[model samples]
Target: MRSTTYYAHGLNIKSELFFPEFPLKQTSEIDVIIRFGITNLFNDSSKNFREIYLSKFIQIKITSCNLLYLFWNDIQIFTIKNNEIIINPNTGLDLNYIKFLLFGYGFAILLYLKGRLVLHANAVDMDNSAVVISGVSGIGKSTLSFAFHQKGYKLLCDDVLSINIGKKFQIVYPSFPRIKLWPDVIKNFEEDPEMVPKIHDKTSKRFYNVSGNFSDIKKQIRAIYFIKVTGDIKIKEINPQKAMMELIKSSYCYKLLNHHEISENLSQCSAIVNKVPVKILEVKKSYESLNKLVEIVENDILKN
Candidate 1:
């Protein structure tokens, strides 16, 4: 297997897949090793798990020992065994599924298992600090980060915010330099959506390469913003209790958490809320209003 060593979320990962777009560095020591191989993941008859989450397209099981089984629609199955992940992809599976598996939710869970506070947020660097922008899907987290990129602010991470929680501070690690954008977002930038390359065939979303628009350095989080798309443009500071609830709600794969994991995750959220400035940002969804919304957020960040 061909392997490449890369740095992401402040960890040295030796992955069998050739993900060269990340900040690559050759190293003899590896913190996490990812391998592409075959396994009978569907045959979990003998294995035991304490918590289970099932849906029409996905099934996730978390063991009492903290082991995880993530199955993606029969296309792929990921079994996290310690620091190593054995990915079993069906024969002749679409390459898009592989990309989605590796980039989308794969590493998020891995980071969670590694004891980092992972959030579904996009982050940008401003004044030597990271400002995290989070919300539900389609709420324009990445689009706003892209707008910040246009203004010369460095994009720290596009999707996942792997946080290093200290006593009085929280630092968000840098991710790979790419942002996924929908057709509407491209149109808002006055760009032809048809010209952009789609990330997957099942969706209209495309990957926007932010190689030059990103920073290689991770930064301490100075603020967090939860965005709402259908309201008048405004920003409001959220209290710690409310921020904790919002953080838990916005977490990726939160439903699969066991009782212990849920408590730990909530504690982490509370810690973050206590230390960082958390706020709710309400902005109207329109091409004409995007710039004004960016300016509003910029002003808030500058003042605080």
Candidate 2:
């Protein structure tokens, strides 16, 4: 099969499998390579691997050679070594499901291995700088990002944020131009949920392609917000000390990090808190208040 080149998170990726989510790029220098192959890490007789993470949907193991194995039941298996990812998919498995796994969890782990600070957050370009919004699952992070996109702000990324921490500044790289939304949220946007493509067969979630309003270049981070559902809309700045802890908790694939990576993560988080403003955004749980929330955040960011 002919290979394709794509760019995301500041890396040039050459892959055998097609990734509809990523923007195509023509580059001779490749930072990562992904190919389809049969993975046998689970059946290896050496047994030098140790299981590091286990969840209902996925399991991870690492070998002494630094090879990471990600298993998604019998449907798909991935072996990540160096800058290469080998994917093994079961026969008759839908390509959409494979793409979902490769782009989400698989790519997050790959970014972590490459020594990038990854956050489980939604990022948007606000006034030439990046602003991040993070919260627990189903807490409207993507919804808020969509609101920003609708208001003429360019979206940087959704779900996984990759950052390059410098001595005095941190830059956030754009990850594709896609946002996942629930069926009801689609309806709130005056769009037919059934008309949109589902993220996976197991869920009613749909993805919106926003390539037209995507910020493809990297941007300096201006602020970070940890949101919660509250009775009213309020935005309070967090101190550096407390903000560091919150950033650590919001890291992507944090549970899978080893001790050394955890220490590095702590140092990186500290740097981020000191350089950018971190705040607590209290928002009501009603979609009707989305505009108000966006206005409040925009004003707050502008004032700083």
Candidate 3:
């Protein structure tokens, strides 16, 4: 059996399946253990049902047994029990599809189960502090993060930003050493989009490896920026009331959780806003605006 240890979002996971995008770590104690195996159908006898997130293609289920089950559009199922994960992909389906889901939503849900606060954002390190950038899908979170990385900031994580809250401060843990970007975004960075490896055969998005620009050290979060597209570029601190709302909105899988789960995360989100500066960054969605956008964030976030 192939096995490896990957460090992601403050967890040291030892998995039977290999995830090349994550940096290898040597640890005797593993926070999570994963294994890829044959599929098992969700038991109808299970009760205390909650649909974490449901789409036409995929749905996540939480049963009375506390098992978190992720069904991938008839192609595969990911079962998480405690710290152990079992991925059961359809025999004939492409493994790449399963792989893509596993790293993205699969890991986010697992981290939530572990009680680690996870955000759907990309973060970069600036002088040992984390600046998190979040927005709705296709708002260029990863692309802007990549731009920060090119400008000498170490990329902390992309897509899923996990934070550890403490009495005095919050720390953002480093995630995988890669970012998923669309073809046009890759082209903006002066790279051939075609040369970038596709995330899955079914999608045109590709992953950019940033091993040299990756940072494993956890940093105290300095600010959180919720980006949006606008005709003109601007950055401003968000009102506390709106910041709380943005925090709730930017959280990973917030819609899928039960009322209790939602309440718990809400408290966490409320507490986080008290410590970190939550701001809105508005900019035009064009390559010509990226440099100026980065400059504005650096001046505001790094200086404050």
Model 3: weakest 10-residue lDDT segment is: 39-48
Give the RMSD in angstroms, all C-alphas superposed, for model 1. 2.1
Q: Rank the candidates by lDDT, best first.
A: 2, 3, 1
Q: Number of clashes in model 1?
A: 0
Over 4 Å off in model 1, which ranges? 41-46, 54-56
Quantify all predictions' global Cα lDDT against the true fold.
Answer: 0.79, 0.87, 0.83
Pairs that collide, model 3: 52-256
lDDT of 3 by residue, 191-225 (tens): 89888789989999998888898888899999899
Find the 10 residues in a row with the least total lDDT in model 1.
46-55
**Number of the top lDDT candidate:** 2
Ranking by TM-score: 2, 3, 1
lDDT of 1 by residue, 1-304 (tens): 8888988778788888677557887889888888877766336554666544444776666665566777766554777764877776553656666667667677888888877788889999988999899998778899888888877889899887788778878878898888888888888788888987788788889887778878778799988999987569899876778898889887875776667878888888888887888999998877677788779988998898
Error of 3 at 160 (Å): 1.1
lDDT score at residue 301, model 1, on the 0-100 scale: 87
Whole-model lDDT, model 1: 0.79
lDDT of 3 at 189: 79
lDDT of 2 at 159: 92
